[model samples]
Target: MQRGMYESRAYATLLLKNILEVADPMHIMNLKPLVFTEVSDRISDKATKAALHILVNICPWGRNRHKTVEAGAISVMIELLMDEITHSKIDNVGSNLALLSLNLNAPYKIHSIHME
Candidate 1:
């Protein structure tokens, strides 16, 4: 998957972006905990970042955002961010931050709650 990102960035982004349109994003939500575990287990810059990018990108849509939050993304991402901070992996830090930001903002996307 990392290699695929390098081979074609557009395709990689598109693949992640389009996952929200699937027949059942909730199914994907169901497996997200396992996926989150795998992401932390992988711990490689490219792999983890790709996974986070995919997860975060899918979160802007209201339903997808709710599903992602239900998947424990906030907690998982916080843990990942802490780990990345300890190692000072600047490359992954940006992605981790983005994931956290998206994860936190996801709840607001569910309703009329305004976000500053």
Candidate 2:
């Protein structure tokens, strides 16, 4: 049954995805750390990359979806940090853009990172 499937750890990622789609600011703020930790611990690099790609593409600037993507993308960024090339190549533009879109007043601290 759907309930049983949702209860399983194996379906955690899918559940996260669904939650992300409909989550509000408070929901996203609370869930961010937990989801990041889980993705950091459980997802593979390939999955991380794919997730990042999806997050980046689906969540555009100045949209509600951007917040969801930002939360999820932060996890992908942490996971990507394990690989030198990816860590360096993946810029913080997306993060900055997401923050800007949300109208959150925070200084941009990630722009100094050199992506190559």
Candidate 3:
């Protein structure tokens, strides 16, 4: 059987955490638009989660949120959320979208995601 998206996201998150610890994640921040666009692609559950994990990790740093917003985080995240929830039938997307919005201070039409 295929692994679940949660497992994919968890592994992706772990790998990104390692990258952050070892390398300069500043490179990631620099490439914000391309990175966000890749996540918006949603090519696979694993890929999507990996990109989102990177996005989430990088956004906490200085000016990274601004970079993300400049990179079109709001639109990309909204598309990713809509695609995950509506098209691909994925789960746990709302949380990531909310996290991006909170980091970017992005106002969006979709709301009501609670911490659980």
Candidate 4:
């Protein structure tokens, strides 16, 4: 999905979340960039939450976990978490981060979080 397509992006993210829930192969789409972009886009809460849901569904898979870290999901997730912490509005972002941390590249992912 494109950046300008806010409503469409939200719908697409929810759709992907449902699809991922039904199946485990998250690699079905070029999801890395899409999720990273959406998760980092805090302007739209619907899109961000839906993207985080997608991460929650996909991150349990080893390949998708590493793909999330490679896509800079860790840093963006940390930012989202920090935002949540500051606002006292916690949700699944911390869970998503924990899932992403299960990747083989834990050192790199932790370093990225620190860099953020």
Pick by lDDT: which candidate is best? Answer: 4
What's each prediction's TM-score?
0.45, 0.35, 0.50, 0.62
**Which clashing pairs does model 4 show?**
none
Q: How close is candidate 4 to the true structure, as a TM-score?
A: 0.62
lDDT of 4 by residue, 43-66 (tens): 466656666656645554546566
- Each prediction's whole-model lDDT (CA): 0.50, 0.42, 0.55, 0.56
Query: lDDT by residue for model 2 over 1-116, one digit each (tens)?
Result: 12334235435554555556566644544443334434433354444443443343234323424454444555455445545545464456555345433333232221122222
- Give the C-alpha lDDT of model 1: 0.50
Clashes of each: 0, 0, 0, 0
Clashing pairs in 1: none
- Which candidate leads the pack in TM-score? 4
Off by over 4 Å in 4: 24-43, 90-116
Q: Which runs of model 2 end up more than 4 angstroms from their true locations?
A: 1-10, 44-116
Query: What is candidate 3's lDDT per residue for 1-116, written digit by digit as tens?
Result: 02346556455544654675456645654654554443444445555555555566566665666666676755765676777676655556756566666755643221233211
Q: Model 1 over residues 81-108: C-alpha lDDT tens digits?
A: 6676778676766655655675557654
Candidate 3 Cα lDDT to native:
0.55
Worst 10 residues of 2 by lDDT: 107-116
For candidate 1, the per-residue lDDT at 110 reads 24
